[model samples]
Target: MRFMVMVKATGYFEAGIRAGKEHSAAKDAFLHDLQDAGVFQSAEELLPSSSGLRVVFPPGGGAPAMQAGPFLPEQEWIADYTVIDVDTEDEALKWVLRMPLPPGQGEHVIEVRRLASGTACALDARAQTMKADLQDQLSLLHP
Candidate 1:
């Protein structure tokens, strides 16, 4: 099963940067262990909400508009994530449960989903179409 484990940030996470270095070392080591176990596919830590952008399209045919950070109804902050491929949902959850978080600081949200292998015919057709498109683009660029 493939699971996208999301680490929800709390106030303490920001506080940690100011609080000191106790949890930082443990957090880094825990991430390393996950990589060593061959269970870690990818991980990324996001910036504060104020740095994000929200894009929305107009009701008619107007172009999309972008708004700067901190959208309304502030809820749980998404801090980081780890995508892991495990044996089962249970296993994925187990892995997520073991992830280290700033002590009493943040919430860990684990979303597990069974990976799907799409129809071979569909994939093959898409690949062929992409190849044709790429060739056309290359010809246009070169010619």
Candidate 2:
């Protein structure tokens, strides 16, 4: 199974400066361990929304408006994320729970969600056969 683990930010724009060094070190170490485990496929720490772009449509059929910067509430910020492949959702959740948060922060919230399945790989029979073989291998390995 594959899961996307989201770490939500409580507040931001220099929030980390307030969190002490111990917190930073712990988080770094945990990330390192995750990578070392071979479970990590990809991971990235997000910049505060202030650095992004947002396009909003006008009330009518006029051209859509464009704007940038911190567009929403601070509570919506995501601290970081990791995409992991594991045996099951349960195992993925356990991995997410092990990640550490910055010091003085509230409980680090990690959202683990399963990746979608049952998508056709291609229109060709070879592709279909390959997908079936892969699925069968996974089932046998996990079971």
Q: lDDT at 63 for candidate 1?
A: 90
> Backbone collision count in every prediction?
0, 1
lDDT of 1 by residue, 1-143 (tens): 45678776556553335324766676678778888887766678787666778788888779999988664435566777777767777888777667766555435454455546442232345678999999999999999
> Model 2, 131: alpha-carbon shift in Å?
23
* Global lDDT scores for all candidate models: 0.67, 0.72
Clash pairs, model 1 backbone: none
Q: What is the lDDT of residue 40 in candidate 1?
A: 68
| TM-score of candidate 1 on Cα atoms, chains taken together | 0.64
Name every residue pair that clashes in candidate 2. 50-70
Please identify model 1 stretches exceeding 4 Å from their true place. 14-20, 58-62, 73-75, 104-143
- Candidate 2 total steric clashes: 1
| Highest TM-score scorer | 2
> Which TM-score value belongs to model 2?
0.65
